[model samples]
Target: MPKLLLAGAGHAHMAVMAAIPELVAKGHQVTAIGPGERHYYSGMGPGMLGGTYQPEEISFPVRDMVESRGGVFIQDKVARIDPARHVVILDSGHEEPYDVLSCNLGSFVPQGVVACDNQDGANGPGAAVASRSVFPAKPIEQLWKARQRVHELTRDHSIRVGVCGGGPAALEIAGNAWSAGRENGGNGCVVQLFTGGKLLRNMPERVCRLAGKVLRKRGIEVVEGSYVRSVQSGEIHLENGKRYVQDVIFLALGVRPSPVFRASGLEVSEDGGLLVDQCLQSLSHPDIFGGGDCITFVPRPLDKVGVYAVRQNPVLLHNLQAHLEGRSLKAFDPGGAYLLIFNIGGGQGILYKSGVAFGGRAPFWIKDFIDRKFIKKFLPNAPSETH
Candidate 1:
């Protein structure tokens, strides 16, 4: 009998969990390790913060899903990989050996970039900066706490909310923070977005303009071309020597792959992600595999987004099984242009795909419907049948 160990409960591992019944039936043991009991969907994180959806509505309980399907679930984080010994070291100091290993460890927001100091404030396993009460916008679950903090601050008096970063996640979080501060007996709440460069710097110009227009309409000031140098004591410092103090700040400074690969001395890419071929197998260790934000594709670097993780699901599902059965592996094709939608809160979203972009109530509705449907598949009561 073979043992398969899943490193993290991320988007790429959903299909693998769904196929657990089949794997278990084949005289194999499957175990999944995750830091939390539930895996929050990144797509709906902003909406969750804005109270558009409850926590239960947007997250999949990792334990229930895996256990219900005859798979073992470990509620702990992976600290390091001892690939030479074919063992995984847990944060709790336990070791688990496996015949095959898959890492979907995911990414974290790099706080060092936001703080621009040695503070290393980026979010990993939901930790905050020691010097300041700054929140890094990764690990997804922290957004819920951020919402609570905003609510508490808004109740007594007007609060200033600052969001750093120019990416979509930064925009969504800023808008959601604005929404959270304005509700539940809230007073005046001011929101400001400080981007290092043009907002939506990579997207089409029209998309950037429309998003900025909507944000300003909602009373959220868009501060373009302002690069954050350091953050301390709830004050934002710009590289050009401008400083703005805020009551609350959300760091969306962008994400970097988990440091475990580099720390473990694996053959990592320039970005410190595990280097993998098109087959999604590690270049150095054939027994090791990965998907999602943790692995850098050798053919081309992939953007860290939920869409790629979703696309890699079926490939990992097929390849993992094939590897165990001594069958030929399948290469993962990243496919064509994918859909992108930003939930800017207040029943509004900006959607873009294949060069067609739209904004308004329709886009928000479409985004909500899509997110809900995707989450329904992994619910505890969902059918046990594999696709």
Candidate 2:
């Protein structure tokens, strides 16, 4: 039997894990490695922050699912991938050799861009730069904890919350905070959304306009044409020389691939994502494959959304199986358009797909139902009826 090692229980790996029995029946030994006991669904993350769902509601236990499939479950983060040796080195210093490797390792917030330097003698994650008020939006666990801390500390203060970046993440954070703050009796918290260009610049103009309206109605101050230069001493400094004192800062800047990949020596995209072909296999290493946010499909410049990883599942599994069996692999082609859902907080959502856009409370219900069904399937009590 061919030994296959799957790294990071992200969207793509979860799909493969769900289909593991078929691969096992075909005579392949599979093992999965990742950091958490539960796999958080990125699709519902914004809703999770908005109090629409608890962490348990948005996540499913990966270790349980994998072990049930008779696959090895290593609850550890991969420290490095030594493709040359066909082994994955875990943070615990143990190595797992494999005949084929699938990498679904996701990206984290770029510390260099988010954290503030210890400019004012304050030591923290982003201490090298002049921004003492910088915050990173990733490693969701840390971000969530930090957000809780902010809420606790600013409970009594006249909070001035400033969110940076114009992406979907930034909007989600700003929206969720604004909606939650109102419920907590923290009215007029001075929520501000600052983006260098148009908010949601990459998205359709209509969506951006709708988002701007929602933010404005929720009392969020929107600042455009402003580029952040540096952070200093509880203040946000803009490239245009405007500065503002913010009680809390949230960095919603774009994402980049994990820096550890550089040490792995795998071919990477300009933006630091693993460069992969149509089959999701590493261009430089045949045995290594990647999906999720850490990889970019070379044939298309699609948004690095979780849906891509979802769609890559069958293709990844098929290609990995074929490669192990010495058979030709099939290529994957994503449809021209995909479903886009945005959480606007308070059990509300906006969904867009193929030039059609709709927003209302009903979409939120649909989102919740879909998310919960996914969670149920992987839960320990899911029905045993074979697919």
Candidate 3:
């Protein structure tokens, strides 16, 4: 039996772990490595922010799941990968050998956007001064800390929050902030959402408009058609040189592929994503496989959303098993028209898919049900609650 090294306990990897029993039965030893006890479902993240679901409801025990499969779960980050030597170096200075490697290591939020100049002039004299206010919304713990910091900062005083992104997460954060503020003390806090392009650019215009409307109706200010050039202590500089004051700024501009893999000497795309072929195998190495946000299939443009990773699980599993057995590989194609539901806080959601849009509490309920179902299926049961 060949030993498989699975790096990153991300959504894709978690899905693969849920089916690890079959893989183990097929004569393969799977070793999972990631630095987390729980895997939080991104779909329920918005609901979590909206206070619709508790944090525990969104996260499942990955440590427990891998143990159930009788597989080794090393809760450590892969510091480096040596493709030629077929070795993965861990952060703790341990090394592991792999017969085959599958990378679902997820991705990192772009440092360029987060560390970009904050022209607010509050931090320093320079006009292009970078703000220390960046909050990278990956690795789960960082985002959790950010939320905690925001809550602590806003507890005693009226706060003005600015979210820097037009994506679903930004909208969800803005909505969550507004709803939380309203519940605590309406008008005392202000939630502002700023976007570089129209919100949800890939989605239909009508859908974006409806989303904008729903946000506006909730008293959340939506700023569109502009990029935040820089941010200062209490001000945000727009690309047009206009400045808006903000007490708190969220650097949720966008997410990019993980830089760790690129640092490993793999062939990455121009956009910094792992270059993978149709079968989701790395172009540079035949023994390695990759999927999730870090990979890009140029022939078919797909969203870096979690759904695509989830959909790719079966194919990844099949192709992985076949590759190990020296059988023919199968091709996996991502379909068009991704179904998206954006949580607008206050127990409401805006559904958008294939140019149609729907917004209501019913969608939120459906989303909640779906999210719970997913968590129930993939979450590995833990021995005890440590968190």
Best by lDDT: 1
lDDT of each: 0.87, 0.75, 0.74
Question: Residue 108 in candidate 1 has what lDDT?
Answer: 91
Total clashing pairs for each candidate: 1, 6, 1
lDDT of 1 by residue, 1-387 (tens): 899999999899999998898999988799999999999999999999888999888899999899998999999999999999999999999999999999999999877644422355443323346533467788788888888888888889999989998889999998888888888889857988999898888989878988988887888887876699877666888888898998888889888899999999999988899999999999999999999999999998788999899889888988888898898999999998888899998888999999899899898999999899989976777765443
TM-score of each: 0.94, 0.90, 0.88
List candidate 2 segments past 4 Å from native: 114-135, 184-188, 380-387
Which 10 residues in a row give candidate 1 its minimum summed lDDT? 116-125
TM-score of 2: 0.90
Q: Which digits, one per residue and each the tens of the lDDT, describe model 2 over residues 1-387?
A: 799899888887766787777778889999999798888887777665555666777777889888887788999888888888889999999999999998888887654433444536555545543442345566565345544645564567657778878898888778776665555654436788889888888888778877877887777888888787755567777889999888667777788876556778888888778888987888988888888898877888767777788777778877888889998887878767877778878777777777777777876787778777766765654643222
Q: Pick the candidate with the highest TM-score.
A: 1
Winner on lDDT between 1 and 2 is 1
> Looking at candidate 3, what is the lDDT of residue 250?
69
